[model samples]
Target: MPNTQQLQDLTTQVRRDILRMVHKVNSGHPGGSLGCAEFFVSLYQNIMDRKETFDMDGIGEDLFFLSNGHISPVFYSVLARSGYFPVNELNTFRLINSRLQGHPTTHEGLPGVRVASGSLGQGFSVALGAAETKKLNHDKHLVYSLHGDGELQEGQNWEGIMYAAANNIDNIISTIDLNGQQIDGATDDVLPMGSLRAKFEAFGWTVVDIEQGNDIDAILTGMAEAKALTGKGKPVCVLLKTVMGNGVDFMMHTHAWHGKAPNDEQLEIGLAQNPETLGDY
Candidate 1:
């Protein structure tokens, strides 16, 4: 198992990968992807019980779905670094006919991706279905998913939330990146979904809050807690409070970088903030 420092190094490397991938394409969502680096690293490295090889069925191992797929840069980085695919494949991100599309798609037969998820708010339902399948098949492993807080504005998520609790899909853990900012502006300004914690609890799911979502140790600890909550008759929800465009100084506190790639100077500054640790792709 990787120790704390090793995980931290990987997280830093993943952040570098995100910045480079987006900057290369000159088109991609960097803000949310940067914000989720730690979560993805901690998850694939420490928290998950993954199989030796990749398979779409995920019969006896933990399954992860990226519902907020616009952050494909982070997801693809983690998967590759975690041995799901070639790390150098990251150079193909957002390129024509690459498996690493702007949003993850199964049509390319990507090893780590199970669903096409650029369309927001659909992950919860998809995760619920996988969780229910695990139950029926008597698979002891879990299903995990990540959602953008802003994506919850879609009505389908509430339906999935209600379905998960009502049907007692307790083996799934759904985490929301509560970064506050989205494409339009802050989620509140665009379309306020008040008190996600309250809304989740009201729906009868158990919620775990990771107030320091950017920290590696915090993500591991909080995710371990979320894992422990599995099989307890309620679906688990982790509300991770992250900063969109985390790590880069200029991009840290706003939604301006949501879907924009950094220019040459900006990429240099951003990469300097997160010095390469595990070597860049």
Candidate 2:
């Protein structure tokens, strides 16, 4: 297991990778990716029960799915740095013919990723299916999924939520990256996720809140609590309060940076706030 300092360093490196990769590609969502950096780092580095050797079936091991696939930079960085692939492969991110596409896919046989999830609101259903399969196979490991706050506007997510609750798919922990911004605009302006906690609670999910989604320690503790809440014959939902484009001053407090890559000057400014800790990919 990685120590707390190592996890912190890994989170920093993942943040650096998010910026560098997006800056290199000149296209990709940095806001959400940066916001979820610490969460992903903590999962891949310290929390998840994953294996070095990839397995498609995910039998006897934990599984994670990225519902809002626009955050591919952070996911790819964490996976590569977690020994899923070569860290140098990050240079090919979003490039033509690269396994690391703008959105994550299992088609390229990516070792760590099992689903292709650019379309929003599908990950929850997919995670429920995985959980059901785990029960069918008599496996004890859990399934995890992450969704965007704005993405919850899709109707399929509600259907999945209802299905999971009704069917008692309790071995899955679903998280919402409640950064309050999407590519088009603010979530409230676009379609406010009014009282998401209450909404999930009404849906029969055991809801938990993470006040500081950007902090590694806070995220770790929240995830541990979320894990404990699982398998109680109810689905778990974590409403993660995260700042869009966290750790970068100019990128925060606005939705303009949601899908925009930082220009040369802005890139330098963003990088200044997040120093290269474990060396940029």
Candidate 3:
């Protein structure tokens, strides 16, 4: 297992990968990708007990689904750097016939992806089904999923949340990236779903809050708490409060970069802020 410093270094590199990948394609979502870099690094490197090899069924191994799949840049970067595929393959992002599409697709045989997301409000349903399947098969491993705060505006997510609690799907932990920014503008300005904590509790799910979602140690600690809350009869929800475009000074706290790629000069500035922690793809 990697220590805290190593995970932090990998997070910085993941941020760089997000910037470069989107900049090259001249299109893609970077704000949420950057905000959730630390969470991805911490989950893949330290939290989930993944197998050495990849498979679709994933029996006896923890599985992850990206509900908000537009952040494929960060997911692709972290998966590649974590050895799911060759790091150089990142260059093909959003290209014609590339496995690394704008949103993750399973039909293309992407190693780490298991669902076709980005349609919003469906990932939680898929994850609950997986969690229930694990129980049916007697597999003790967990199912994990991530959702965007803005994505929760979709009505299907609420049904999935209600279903998970009703069915006692305790082995899954679904995290919401509470970054406050989405494509149009701030989530509040768009459509505020007030008090996510209270809502989750009302739905009969256990909720854990990582107040400092961008910090590596805070994420690790909060996830540990979430893991501890599993299997007692309710699903777990982690409210990860992160800053959109966290590492880049100009991009922080703004929705302007939600799905916009930085220009040459902006890319240079973003890269300079993160520095080359591990070699770039």
By lDDT, the better pick of 1 and 3 is: 3
lDDT for each residue of candidate 2 in 135-165, tens digit (9 for 90 to 100): 9999989999999999999999999999999
What would the TM-scores of all predictions be? 0.99, 0.98, 0.99
lDDT of 3 at 257: 88
Q: Assess candidate 1 and give its TM-score to the true structure.
A: 0.99
Output the better candidate (2/3) by TM-score. 3
Query: Mind giving the per-residue lDDT tens digits that candidate 1 earns over 1-281?
Result: 89889988998898899999999989999999989988998899888899969999999999999999999999999999999999999999989989998899999999999999998889999999999999999999999999999999999999999999999999999999999998989999999989999999999999999999999889988999999999999999999999999889899879999999999999999999999898988
**Which lDDT value does model 3 have at 193?**
91
Q: How many residue pairs clash in all the candidates, one count each? A: 0, 0, 0
In model 2, how many backbone clashes occur?
0
| lDDT scores in order | 0.93, 0.90, 0.95
lDDT of 1: 0.93
- How do these models rank on TM-score, best leading? 3, 1, 2
lDDT tens per residue, model 3, 12-43: 99999999999998999999999999999999
Alpha carbon lDDT at 62, candidate 2:
95
The reply for model 1, stretches above 4 Å from the true place, is none
For residue 141, model 2's alpha carbon misses the true position, in angstroms, by 0.6
